[model samples]
Target: AGGRVLLVEDEMSILKFTARMFQKHGFQVHTTAMNGLEGLEMMNRNIYVAVFTDINMPVMDGFECVRRFRDWENESEERRSLRGGRQFVCAVTANAGPQGDRDRALRTGLMDAFVAKPAKIMDLVAMARRSAEDTLGHSNGN
Candidate 1:
């Protein structure tokens, strides 16, 4: 079986492409959301090895969604224990206006990784693989 993943994007094309790329790289099951609000709902009911969310979207932007999701995730010991490792979520942005914007987002620590617009699928897949390994290493308190 392949890892489970979630793709939160408003653009249909990007969503489809990202999902296909993830599947090609061994993420067999992936859920999609058109907005951040929907993304949060999906996160509440499922377990995903990774989540790729666009920074800008209607109905609750990526930042807020991730913030709330993290809050919910850290709410209880049981919830945290249910995971094999740390929560992994990536922020995808098309903000090429300034490098400071990207740097600020990273400094916020809301996501495990960040992917700029026109990102390379191979790079994304590689990062996910590394993150999964690192996260899983913390499983069973080992």
Candidate 2:
């Protein structure tokens, strides 16, 4: 199994397309959310190979969500011990390009990667494949 992936996107079309692509690439379980708040809620329920989140959304934005997620992961001894590190969070959004988002995310240690919108969805699948392999190597599963 490819394990699970969490997709946090406000766009309905992008969300569905991304989910199908991940499934086609052999990911067994896919969890989806329309906004960062919903994304954070999913985080509490299951471990993911990777999280692909859009930068903009209602109620909560990706940056804040990732910040909170990192905080929660750090605070949760159980999670830290089980995973051995922070979960992979990748930004998948229209705003990811030409704005130094990648640099900012890296510098701030908020997100691990970024995929600008309208690019190859294959990049995300490939990343998930690598993440799943790496996660399985170190993790005991959730």
Candidate 3:
């Protein structure tokens, strides 16, 4: 088993596929939410190594979710105690319109990475592996 991961997506197929991919790769746990609000609740309750969130959701979008998560990380001491520090947050979106969108997401400083929609499963798997390794390295003060 590897690390815990959270997937927040409104599309059922995508959510299931992503979860399966992580599970097949031996992630210890894979939690999912259909909206940002639910994702935020899950984040508060459990510790995750990484979170893959869709930009467009019905109730509470990913941007708001990222904002809230960042706020919680900065303000909540108890939550920080649970997770040690901030977890990696990745944005998954179909809106690969202009480079500006990617730039905007990055400027938020909430999203660690961005994966455009129709992303290859292998790419996602590679990102997860890298995230886990990075998290482990940081935890060990590397």
Candidate 4:
């Protein structure tokens, strides 16, 4: 089943198209800017089952956003379900499979998956489904 999605994107066109796709697939969608800081703030305010964020932006990059989100897990007692254990964050970048970028995302423990830009609709749907399943498992105390 499709789940709630938090989309952090800088590119307007991509964001619009992706949002549309999420809607078509029966997922609830929330959106934020390219800035990691703002995205973090949004996550704190809402409960998303999964997040899809871009890698680069003007104010704060995706890497920094992910880092902050991961860091939040340590310092806070009240973790928002939007940004909690079952919520997955995925990198949707135009890095063209750059190993360093992928490695950085992995090392930070922020992203659960990475997909190159212009991602296939099916891929996005599949990831969202997987995230939903994972979240259900966590919710069930698994």
Q: Mark the 10 consecutive residues where model 2 has the least summed lDDT.
A: 95-104
Q: In order, how many clashes per candidate?
A: 0, 0, 0, 1
Per-residue accuracy of model 3 over 25-134 as CA lDDT, tens digit each: 88754555999999988877777777888888988999898899889888888665543467788888998677654667987888988988887877777777888887
Q: Every model's Cα RMSD, please?
A: 2.0, 2.4, 2.1, 2.3
TM-score of 3: 0.87
- TM-score (C-alpha) between model 4 and the true structure: 0.86
Q: lDDT for every model? A: 0.79, 0.81, 0.81, 0.77
After superposition, candidate 1 runs with Cα above 4 Å error: 99-101
In candidate 1, which residue pairs get closer than 3 Å at backbone N, Cα or C atoms, i.e. clash? none
The Cα RMSD in angstroms, rounded to one decimal, for candidate 4 relative to the true structure is 2.3
- What tens digits encode model 2's per-residue C-alpha lDDT throughout 1-142? 6778999989888888888888887785454688999998888777898898888899998888889988999989888865557798898767654555666676797888888777487898888888887887786654
lDDT of 1 by residue, 57-109 (tens): 99989889989988898885666876653578888888845664367568788
Predict model 1's lDDT versus the native.
0.79
lDDT by residue for model 4 (1-142), tens: 4778888998888888888899899998876565677787877666676788888886888888878866775565666332334357888888846576677777777788988877887898888888787777766767
Candidate 4 weakest ten by summed lDDT: 78-87
